[model samples]
Target chain A: MKAPCTVALDRTPLYDLHIASGAKMVPFAGYHMPVQFAAGVLKEHLHTRRQAGLFDVSHMGQLRLIGVNAAAALEALVPGDIQGLVPGAMRYTQFTGPSGGILDDLIVTKAQDHLYLVVNADRKAADLAHLRANLPRDIAVEPMEDRALIALQGPAAARVLERHAGGAAGLKFMSSAAMPVMGFACIVSRCGYTGEDGFEISVAGQDAPALAAALLDEAEVAPIGLGARDSLRLEAGLCLYGHDIDTTTSPVEAGLAWSIGKRRRAEGGFPGDAVIRRQIAQGVTRRRVGLRPDGRAPAREGTPIADKDGRNAGAVTSGGFAPTLGAPISMGYVRAELASIDTPLDLMVRGKAMAARVAAMPFTPARYHRG
Target chain B: MSETKFTEDHEWIRVDGDIATIGITDYAQEQLGDIVFVELPQTGDTIDQGGDVAIVESVKAASDIHAPVSGTVETVNDALVDEPGKANEDPEGDGWFFTVTLSDPAELDDLMDADTYKAFVAKL
Candidate 1:
């Protein structure tokens, strides 16, 4: 049967490889991405948790802010203390708007004389514009469009990486190093969105397909699609841009206050400093918490969360049937008083009130290797 | 024995003696992707024609399974409660949703026959 015609919204370096794998291509973030492969979504999700899964996240934006004033210039826009980011260390941070709402969450890695960053694929254009408009003239914001980002996540991810990239085994969680993989030099970071001990490889776009193929050749590595990626991240309590964290959610309300560096809070700089500092001091009214449904039914996004008296407490931002948990799990914003562990709650699913309870941030334990 | 008929919604029903076994077509299961959960009505519930009698949830979305003909539900496929993937694995056999006692077997004439269903699925 002829495959459906995929309009190339944008093509990654591994576009041909995805097509050969019988992937169902869908437009996402101005790029044609594989939503699912021939094995289907369920199998793909299961495979990733059991074994290593390679994901083509090339659609996400990669950039570098160069010059001596780069970190200082970046600190003006984000809540992170960029100046204190030691080289080879990565930090999860967010770009805040004027009113203290999050513009987008991004990973910032300090390289030699430059600040390497990765942002959400859908928010690339806006993020670039935000950087250009806010950054000082001395700092050069260079977009790394020639690079491709790939994630190898699962229990066997470290072993697969050690075999492909010689020095990858030495890297600890949230740390990165330049290593040679498949004869191509790339930056490998011991971090991932799946809450597993995984590595995200930033390689030249031209070398991405070969490296991806090499990783997939290993018995432990499988090609995961976006469908599984979403489910895995949801299970890990990681927020997705445009869904969980948006331009209206602040770091305090999103339960990401830890991302704000202690130095930044004490020094009191960055945009919306007054509002964010106040939230950190007094505590935010609403906080993001994990919810477990009492029944087998999944409480999907936008489901209304209710208190004991049936009053609207919050709304579900992300939810799905967690394959790992073997039950319905969800994450949503709830009143600060109701964000305690094991607090009883209810989810309004399809007009029917379903019993639920507020659990911890991650429904499953994160398996990232600290060492 | 009367001929089996199919609906555009992908439901199928075959009448043998006084009982009619109902299930979703293979094409329906394929379109729904991997079935993770199924909510079926109790065996004795009376369902009107075209009314929702069951729900099938896939990884991507959820859909309601409508009663193909007016009838009183006789027995449900209890196996589906444990293994919903049976719908994807065998939509026409072990994946049968429920059995119903037809209120009016004459209503079967309104459904499409096997050959017509074959052609109907071809268009999809």
Candidate 2:
């Protein structure tokens, strides 16, 4: 989630820790979050790919949905098959509007008695309101406001985490378990936004500082900030809530058909099931694809995407210099016909055309711990 | 002999006779974080003081690099094209954006000197 430009920015539980570490804090999702630590974005970005980078993601809305019908209640909102989610497993999904447009992408996990949801901080209020109004009164959507989330991500994430909680090393991707770390109780999940083998640990707000400190104490771990996080996710080909997917962008157009479960696809129960099914059967007009801009110049968001002949094709949704690739990369929607890999295009930046081509995402391969 | 001045827009200029070399302030580069690309005005282009002339892109956002004084573009630092991070490494040195033949040397009178720029940055 991106920060709002308001003066009343809130602080995370680890605010003092951030200040002590010489982190450069900026307003993010109504909070004064760190955009970069002393290591800087470039080093932080590279460190996450090569080793472990710790991230503070406490601003997101962590909610617990309870009652016997919680799964069915959530299934009515998203296209994913929530009922099929086994305990300790996580599924990536997004909330859809009536027209099949995305509201916000989130992760859903099922536990012993409730469904765990992690939504964007900016849309938490509306999401809660939507749930309260739509779900049966018996079902409860309780916000976990007292918790702080910390992510330890990268190739060395498992080893770093294992130093504290030995069992964490055994958790596979999209799996979760309650672990006790340094006398603190926390829920650790084998998932992260950076497309790395990592874990997102949710613990009490007061325990965050110590937990974060312990993780950073690892030889391979560094405290990364939002700047590197954005670049990392972009290189991972993940969708950012407000930028990549929004109220007007459908899941199909956003290239998220895999998120829509087969059971839910055949049985239309979700909000935008009809439109989503239609787009799935007959491809959408536009598709989200990775772009490789030729030359050293970087093309940013809103740059016009044009064909070789300078005909308007689409617009860039996200673009930046990938520290891992050492080149400019972008992702945006283009005409489905032109979304094929290797399709030559140009990013019209500053009234001048920069050479670009549609390439296969993720710019880098996803190294999730599926085992 | 040359005089260096700074604009409220966070740009620094070194004036030697009618020629002025322009770049963003060290504070400006620090605030913008790591710069990835720089778009400079072509040589021979006439620009007004405070006119938008170049673009410096970081991983987080793109910031406008404005012309601090009225002048015609003489030459751009082509090296910034390949190594934009120089703006963060040596913002006032090798990161210099372009040189211009000042169309109005009188504009320099209103710009802040080194000490004044330092004080102004302290307040920001």
Candidate 3:
């Protein structure tokens, strides 16, 4: 097993609370974040599906793109329909490199005056640098270091949050509002990484612990760690940055073409637009697909995949035992010809070929509250 | 008379005459968190000392169970295949992975006693 790098680890605002809650802290993206709590990963994952699970996501980068032309300026960097976003509306987009590879995927929410953005923890510094370098000086990139984010996710998330912030319950999915939560003004976005009806609340760093404690006090809420967070997203078939989608993968190949608005596709204004447009017009050679291994033995990341004739097809990028499905699940890039649903494939595990098939994602259906 | 011995790798062995029952220590199960699956050695398979005998997969990762001494597989606890969590619940008892006929009884002398193993774990 690879040893965990523990040098110069950073702590989030809720670090003390996590320690008090018996969290198994591990080095994740340079932060000492909780991997699992006393209840373990399995129980926490189930609780999030049934009730509510509170996750401290302060490690993610939160920033504001200030200026009137912020949306148009950002559109030049990503394929998402940024300028089309109305106030309180959010769009998920990726920062594409000059070669059409994804620099990072982020959530861009149009606030009243500026565009609020949340990026991956590991890519925060690089994203900040990219935004600073690419975006014109007229658009100011303000990194919000004094804020902390908490995600209250699950079927009962809205109910648990409704008690604290009444206005938050009214926000539709992918919408955001500055609501008073626990006596502090917070940006409550009706969205979450988990495929459930949930909210991600951005609050002052100092008030984070208190706010998290208040929410955890609810009967339907439990403090969750990163372990459950991974399984929940995997079951949801969400792409994990640096794993399922990375610098070598294109948005079209990764099955994220829906995020590229129609206007952006026709207008052709973004880094690597030529390559992306070509790939969009014609299909990609390799495509991302979901794999359901036939047995209990999980075909983990980097597991080689073979075709029916025992020829090398592709490799698994992200995989593990899905607690919800009670079977091993995986997501990997395969030859375009074999990316069709129900395509029988073989996952090579420790020199043995395990039976697996390409299945439609998300291994579980998303339960987002559309209204 | 039967005597229990422990290896540095956290496996437990109970020797009765020439037959020895092998399983993981409670400490090993606790470290692995939840066991989702178990891959045990087949009956009649010959395993050398310290060879891979079984595999215990937790929600996090998989760990190999090595033989404490060279022996031929006699019987395995097939119950673990259906309920791998049994290893977490009763690691040293019903969680036994398999039993093997001892090929070298002298290898038992190198194993640590229960008290000595407990002291070894404490230092970790």
Candidate 1 collision pairs: none
Error of 3 at A191 (Å): 1.1
At residue B48, give the lDDT of candidate 3.
Answer: 92
Q: In terms of lDDT, which candidate is stronger, 1 or 3?
A: 3
Native A-B contact fraction in model 3: 0.50
Every candidate's fraction of true contacts kept comes to 0.33, 0.83, 0.50
lDDT of 3 by residue, A67-94 (tens): 9899999999999999999999999999
lDDT of 2 by residue, A1-371 (tens): 23446588888899999999999888878899999998789999999999999999999899999999899989989888899988998899988999999988899988889999999989988888988899899999899999999999999999888888879999999989888977799899999989889999999999999999988888899999999999999999999988888998999999999988889899979888889999999889999999999887778889999998889999999999999999999999899999999999999988889888999988899999999
Single out the weakest 10-residue window by summed lDDT for candidate 1 chain A: A1-10
lDDT of 3 by residue, B30-100 (tens): 78887888999999999999988889888888788899999999999999988898999899999999999
Task: Provide the global lDDT of candidate 1 against the true structure.
Answer: 0.89
RMSD, every candidate, angstroms:
2.2, 2.3, 1.2
Q: lDDT of model 3 at residue A91?
A: 91
Q: Which is better, 2 or 3, measured by DockQ?
A: 3
Q: How would you encode candidate 1's per-residue C-alpha lDDT over A99-146 as one tens digit per residue? A: 898888999999988999999998899999999988988889899999
Better of 1 and 3 by TM-score: 3
In model 2, where do residues sit more than 4 Å from their true spots? Answer: A1-7
Q: Go through the candidates in order and give each one's C-alpha lDDT.
A: 0.89, 0.91, 0.93
Instruction: Report the error of model 1 at residue A218, Å.
Output: 0.8
Which candidate tops DockQ? 3
